[model samples]
Target: MIETEAWVLYERSGGSESALDSDDFRRETFAFPGPAGDELLVEPLFGSWEGNMTHSLQRRPIDICKQRGERRVVIGNGSVLRVLRAGADVRGIHEGDVGILHGGHVQDEFGYTVLVQGYDAPGTVGVLAKRTKIAARNFLPLPLESHHRLEQWAAFSVRYLTAWSNYHLALGAYRLQVNEPLDPAPFVLGWGGGSTLAALDLARRAGCRAAMVSGSPQRLAELARMGIVGIDRRAFAGLEFDEGRYASDPEYHAAYRAAERAFLAAVHDWTGGRGAAIVFDYIGAPVFRASVKALGRQGVLATAGWLLGMQTTVNRAIECIGRHVHVHSHYIRRADSPKAMRYAEREGWMPQVSEIYSWEEIGGLARAAAAGRLRSYFPVYRVNPV
Candidate 1:
């Protein structure tokens, strides 16, 4: 067994709210049984964090390892790594090959993930460790002698793959209804997030008039410089409509209505009443309604995020039949996942990372992320020198 130095939390958090306050991370030694016949031993160059990992940090019983009665699990999902050694059965990829890992467990027929990975996958260690083993199929290699920086590849390793896959769906749906004869260049709008930014980048590159709504002026300005129209999210305040408050509190409903009116009016003024041909709203629940309603006739609304709040209430009758709005909801398709990293690399479309943390600062990264202190849409961290 090759001993690996990794950061681990012996105890899981009791609830979702205190993911940072409990179970402090400690760097310690653990046994790593090298690689299986179909697996490769990889050393990660960098890794990124995502919000979906609350299940592992919270120590939910539903976690894959917890269900199997395992207490210690390595935590990291998105990574850019180098293959140090491969099983004898592995082919095409050998020692010194560099690739990105998109994590998941039990891939379905379409190839996308049904269950999340990282701590969620059984017998798997994440990129946070000194070294880890992964199935050869999960590894996607960058093109030969790629000139992009390690940080750029690290940031793009995870998010851009999903973004490229999903935004392609949105554009295809939009083109189905609004074609070149009707509108050669349809307008696209996406709410703020790393995926949203990546999708918006594609939209702009595809010759669509693209815009992004974000609360951060820095983020908005950055995208704007890249030719994407930036809309301020703060203009429509108190618009996070909770299902519970919206049902009982008449005042909350009225306020939401007022914000909705202002938001739609802004959309009208901006688009000249054309409404967006494609509206991507990955930030589900709080802003789902506005995103759906902002769509024009025969427009496409794309969503997959559920970070802020999960339980959503939508006007099923009005949006579909009355407005002709189509909701394209899913992650990436199986066929779409394989070549996304190389595509993003070729296009030079990488997600922005405002900060990069060090190996010893994993705890600080968790606390800052949980507290909403991260200044960028995506932040990456170092795991190894290579």
Candidate 2:
């Protein structure tokens, strides 16, 4: 057994720790058994804490539905690494192979589970303790040209896949099967957060006019540079933009919903009275109602995350039955990594990484995420331990 240190999270006595101090994360050397079968020991190069990773580490209900036996490492997606050792049966990847690790865990109704690589440590190197049957699907090979941009590739891997799958496969496929051929006249509306940027890119590629809903001035400027329109979520909802008030005050929410008529009217005007063809929203309750209202006839709303809040008050009669709108829920899958990587290479697009840090800086990064202060579209960490 080889001993390597990794960061692990432990459940508290009663409720989970809400605030992130230095004590929440720990680095301990663990004994790892050598690969015996189809497994390949991979040393993660760079990783990022995106939606699931951030939520699992700092969001409320930190221990929601978690049992005593759950995995200690609270990581999710985005790992670009080199393979160290490979078992004889492993076919798709070999020693010294450079690839991105995908997914957190996959499970079926019968309890068959596959824990894809997680960003729990995000900085330290460790052996994959689980089985390796899923590696064939999860490991996506990166081209030699992308080696120098490991941080960029690591940051883009999961976000690109999530956005690509939601837009290209989920929303795009639905449109082709149901109504139109997804023509150039269609408008694509993307909500806030990391996935929105990628979805906007895909929408533009698909010959649609892509627009984003964001409140940050820097983000708006960035979007303009990319030739995408930016709609301030606060201005769109007719609410004075204040992140703190929006979170704590119920009146702002009610007012925001009341201003939906204005928002929908603007959407109609933007689309020449046709409304949007597709709306991408992973934020769940906060913007879901507006997403539903922003759609045109037979439009699709694609979703993956519910970070703001899960439960939303939706009037099914008007939103669904009346408009014939479709709600498609998709989770990131291992196969998406390769598809997105190929698309990125072909399109000459790379991830927008803002910063890179060593593994020890992960705690500070986590604290920033918890405080709602992380501004980088993607922040990645290198796994080099002293």
Candidate 3:
């Protein structure tokens, strides 16, 4: 057994509303019990949190683990895991190989244990093993040493996987499910995040048109450079809409609804007044409502996260009769990661990182992220060098 230290987050049982208040973290060294069977011992290299729903402990607004912690070891978008040691029986993995850590569960038939985190069992080193199966699989291998920054590989791991699954599995498959052919279609990408970038790339690959809505001018500019139509939601941050029917305060909810309307208008114009074939939404509530409204007949609206709040109020009438829109909860399956990686390798895809932090700065980064002061497109943490 090799001894090593890991920083872990401990969410106290039954506690406060704020994750920062209720949770505590510590660094502890424990033995790296050698892989039992097909297990592969891995050290996390680069990671970044989505800061949305899945990363939240008690539905906290911001994600704390993007900066630090080991819970849901494979949950982040750009989290990269390096194989440190491999069990004798392990195949398709080596000591120096790199792969993505995914949040999918291994089936009982596969005989691979899915380790969520070691937080539940103190003093025990949690080992998550990856294995190849006939059916569902999670781990995706990357190109060997050809990549420059480790952070780029990490971001490519999940964000692209998510975008691919959203378009291919969710929307494309949904179209097939309805006895329709999978074809290139217009897409409305809400919130210019990492996944949105990947979706744009997927749209380009599929020969589809895409428009984006974002508050960040930098992200908008980036999308524009890719020939994507972008609508700056910041402009509508103060516009009044519906006579303030959905108004919450002086310039909060009302402004948000106005932005949604503006985004929908842009989508309509971009799609030639036919709306979009698909709308990918990460920001919940009003954006979701807008996505539903902007969908053309038989369109699909796939959502993955709830950055604002999960509870949303959309027009029940449209859901009932106006449109045949399909609203799907988008979660990337284990099988989707490898497919996305294969496509990315062919296209030479990589994530754009805004900040890179050393493994040592995790604590301070977590504090800043908790305070909502951290501004980043993607924050990558380098744990160990190759």
Quote the lDDT for 222 in model 1: 92
Per-residue accuracy of model 2 over 1-386 as CA lDDT, tens digit each: 65566665544445455676565556655544566566667677787767666665663634522532444543445767677777787787877787776653454453222333443323222222211222434567888775337777777776777776677655554566454544544788887577778888877776778888787899899889888888765656553233455679889856765677667776777788877778887777766777877877777777766667676666777765545445554445554456667778878566677788677777777778777778888878777431
Q: Write down the lDDT of every candidate, Cα atoms only.
A: 0.75, 0.64, 0.57
Cα lDDT of model 3 by residue, 121-177, tens digit: 122232211211111134466666654466777766556666776666445544653
Where in model 3 is the C-alpha error above 4 Å?
13-15, 19-23, 30-34, 52-54, 57-78, 107-138, 145-148, 173-187, 238-260, 314-317, 320-322, 327-331
Candidate 3 weakest ten by summed lDDT:
127-136
| Model 1 misplaced stretches (Cα beyond 4 Å) | 11-17, 22-24, 58-69, 323-335
lDDT of 1 by residue, 193-248 (tens): 78788888888898888888887888878977889988887888877878788899
- TM values, all candidates: 0.92, 0.83, 0.77
The global Cα lDDT (0 to 1) of model 1 is 0.75
Best by lDDT: 1
What residue pairs clash in candidate 3, if any at all?
78-154
* Ranking of models by TM-score: 1, 2, 3
Q: Model 3 clash tally?
A: 1
